[model samples]
Target: MDIFADFTQRINVAVQTVLTHYEAGDVDLSRVTVEPPRDESHGDLATNAAMVLAKPLGAKPRDLATRIAAKLARDPDVATAEVAGPGFINLRLHPGYWLKHLAGLLAEGSDYGRGAPTGRKVNVEYVSANPTGPMHVGHTRGAVVGDAIANLMAFSGDEVTKEYYINDAGEQVSVLARSVFLRYREALGEDIGEIPAGLYPGDYLVPVGQQLAERYGAALRGMDEAEWLPIVRDAAIDGMMAMIRDDLTKLGVNQDVFFSERTLHADNGGRIAEAIEDLRARGFVYQGTLPPPKGQLPEDWEDREQTLLRSTEVGDDVDRPLVKSDGRYTYFAADVAYFRDKYERGFNEMVYVLGADHGGYVKRLEAVARAVSQGAAHLDVVLCQLVKLFRDGEPVTMSKRAGNFVTLSDVVDEVGRDAVRFMMLFRKSDAPLDFDFKKVTEQSKDNPVFYVQYAHARCQSVFRQAEGAGLALPDFRALDAGALDALTDEGELALIRKLAAFPRLVQSAARAKEPHRVPFFLYDLAQGFHAQYNRGRDLTHLRFVNPDEASISLARLALVKGVATVIASGLALVGVDAPDEMR
Candidate 1:
């Protein structure tokens, strides 16, 4: 049961009673919002109903809060309601209410914070890195964010599909083919000079060349470019995809669907053309010459009329080109067709995770999806900022030419998947992150991953200590309502209240499409657990493992276990492991 919801209902009923007495004509009740105050001393919950309606009704906010509090007092759930600090009503729930909520958490187990399903199918497409190279740190952030969002949505009752859009057919892949072919020639004992300026210089591709030579031998030595490009391109794309898949696996990410860009116009089928025609029929496509870009233009920039999408009509900064002047479909065109295909497949809601460099592309992509779907489909694009690597306060420079770039596999190898996932999600996706290798691996309270995991381990430690002391733990079936009352300490009650807020947190985070909130909530809850544990260190009487009484110990153990369960559940949603042992 959501105590916040229950309390909100009580307050709403109280406000209605006051409204009936005052006869305030036609006040908007929808404006009333009950929320936990920023400062805990303000109360369990504070509402702005009185302040919001005061000016409309020609009544003072304080007077309204006084009347509302009196009406709220009739409810047994509310022990006391008082107005404090700038017309805010602070509510103190009865102690029994929190204790009973703790029981519900233990009974619910891992399902404690799960919410009802929204029944909307959401397609979360992320880490759609080009299939020409291995994923790097930037791609890892997107992977973690998308994966966490999928997990959070599923937990909150939404149908979520984790997808990866593979850009397997593009000019970049063609470049990859040429690069691999060079490697293949090198494997055939040819003395190729220094790797060209535009070609890939990573040693990772050297093996791809060797493998191709091993498979085809010298038969492809004199083959024409057209004859060998396809064979080499397919091999290179497959090999790169394999490496990317392995890197993602190391980071604990697996895509449910790997959509290929090549499929958009493969064989005789032309979905891209069809999508363009559909838009053209809707008057969204036209032949237009784009004004020269505001900033510096390349010397090769040529002013030409090209087919464009009227994206500005929907909210884009400028109408975007659908086809380049060279008479080839632009990347934007392919993206529009891909989104159309997604909508046709019955996913009305879509999320795209992109790097910060693609910030300018967001508005146009959203506009295209809006126009093509006729506003039926909604698109949310989350842009992840850059991650600066630091080791002992020194910046770690990664150069592509020097072949010194840190791959995703490199980070995973240094610090296990758990540390990488947790650290990546410990901040807002839009904010720049500083990843310190030494700091993340450290086992201390400063390390958020360790701090949260330590709370879980400590809970298990309490259970072990109690069991070793020959204490008879109460049977789950036999524990009565009164047994829970033994947990009467203020800190213990506060921890229970925090646990009770889990479902609401999940609901809000899911609705906002902000999965970073989960890690923040876990950190707050861990702080509570740590505070209570540290308090026991000073007050031996508050300890969970009391030698004097077994019943009290059993009740306290159950409470600790409840904390552990919620922590584990929250960690699972973020794909972070909850360890029973910290080491």
Candidate 2:
């Protein structure tokens, strides 16, 4: 049940009534906002309708607040409604009303917070890591973050497409081909020396080379660079992609699309030339000399004519180059085509989850979306900060036995997928996170994932305890129709109030495109459950299994079910498991 939404609507109705009373029909109710009070003791909710409507209606804030208060105080659902300092109206919902809200939660179960279709198609692109090797820990955060965002948007009724842009057409994949060739020679018993500076050094490619030998043997060894290069390059890209997909599967990130960069250069209706010509026809492309870049200029920097995009007209800091002196398309040129393709695919919004180091590219890509879609589409970039790994307060590095960087597989193997996924989103996306090996697995309140999971498990335990006592949960129709007057305790009201905030949390997090809020909200909900459970320890009547308070125990059991169901729903959004037991 969205208690906040209901109250917000009520407040909106009251504001509209006041506006009509004043004959100020032009006043917009959209400006009025309803929110939870900063301090719970003040009230369950607070509204800024009075302050928002005062100037528009030509009335003082206090005077409008007094009027709004009189209207809301008369609501049977509201136990008290008072005008607070200045113009805020604090509202305390009746205890019986909160109990009914708990019954609503019990009735909804898994379907709670799921939204109806909004008819908007959203594309969330993340983890566009180079297909050069296994994914390292750096890519893990983006993978989890992007996947969670897609999940959240999907749950919130948007048609979401999860995408991964494979960087297979670049010089990096060529290096990977050469590196895998080294391993190929090694597999054939040739003494290939140390991996050179520009080639990939990870041992993960050793398998690719071995596979190449099994497929082609020494036949391609006699061929020149041109002939064997493509063969080996294709093999390397496919092999590396396989390894990357395996790692992503370990973290439960299965993207709906893996867009290949090579396709943009080769097929799919356009290479760089076609897309550039299209932009030129639209007057976004021009041949001119760009001013020198800010800060230190490159050694090759010179005042020379080149093909450039007039991206600055939209929002970019400077007009970007589309073609180089050597007559090849720049990276930005390819991106214009990529974003244009996504726009044509019917996406209204494009979300790019990139590393913080790519901050400079954000404006250029945004300009590309605007230019390509003619201002009909929006592009949002989420820059994920770096993650530092630690084990027992000491920095964790590459595995000694594996002889590779600390890949995503290594972390997932050590900590399991749930901890990895949860801790990755435990902090804000732009904030640097320290993934502590020792702390995440500890069974203590300090570990948020553990704490939240335990709360879910505790809820399950309550159900089992009740079941063992021959108590069965009533059907939803009965639960929905039953009165919960026995649940009048302060703790019971607090728990119900927190449960009422679930739909609000989901809506806000989905709107902000911040999936981290789900985990954060789950932590608070878990803490509330624990607090309520701890309260029952000293007061036998407060316990869920109280023999002397059967009706109250049954009502609290419904609350327990609400906690478990909501926790599961939230963990599903974050791609983490909500365990029935801690172990």
Q: Largest TM-score belongs to which candidate?
A: 2
The segments of candidate 1 whose C-alpha lies over 4 angstroms from its true place after superposition are 22-28, 55-60, 267-269, 298-302, 397-402, 474-480
lDDT of 1: 0.86
- Write down the RMSD of candidate 1 (Cα, Å): 2.2
Residue 135, model 2, lDDT? 88
The per-model lDDT (C-alpha) reads: 0.86, 0.87
RMSD of each: 2.2, 1.6
Worst 10 residues of 1 by lDDT: 472-481
TM-scores for every predicted model: 0.95, 0.97
Tens digit of per-residue lDDT, candidate 2, span 1-583 = 6887788889877776777678876667787777899998899999999998888788999999999988898889999999989999999988878877877777778878888899989999999999988888989999999999899889888999999999998788888889888889888889988888888777887888899999998987999989999999999999989999999999999999999999888853266778789889999999899889889997655478888999989988898888877677777788988887898899999899999999988899989888888999988899999999999999997864235668899999988999999999999999999999999999999999999999999998988888788777656435852556777788877877887888888888888888899999999999989998998898877887765667777777877887888899999999999888877
After TM-score superposition, what is the CA distance of residue 143 in candidate 2 from its true location, in Å? 0.6
Writing each residue's lDDT as its tens digit, candidate 1 over 1-583 gives 6777767777777887788767776667777778888898767877887888787777889999889988776677678888876577878778887877777777778888787777799999999999877788889999999999888888988898999999987779889999999989999999888989888878778889999999999877789988999999999999999999998999999889999899986853388889989999999999989889889995534499888999999999988888768777877888999999999989989999899999988999899889989999889999999988888789877846327577888888888998899999999999999999889989888888888989999888888888899876665534555788888898888888899889999888877778889888998999999898888899998888897977777778888888888899999988988987877
- As for candidate 1, its clashing pairs are 117-157
Best by lDDT: 2
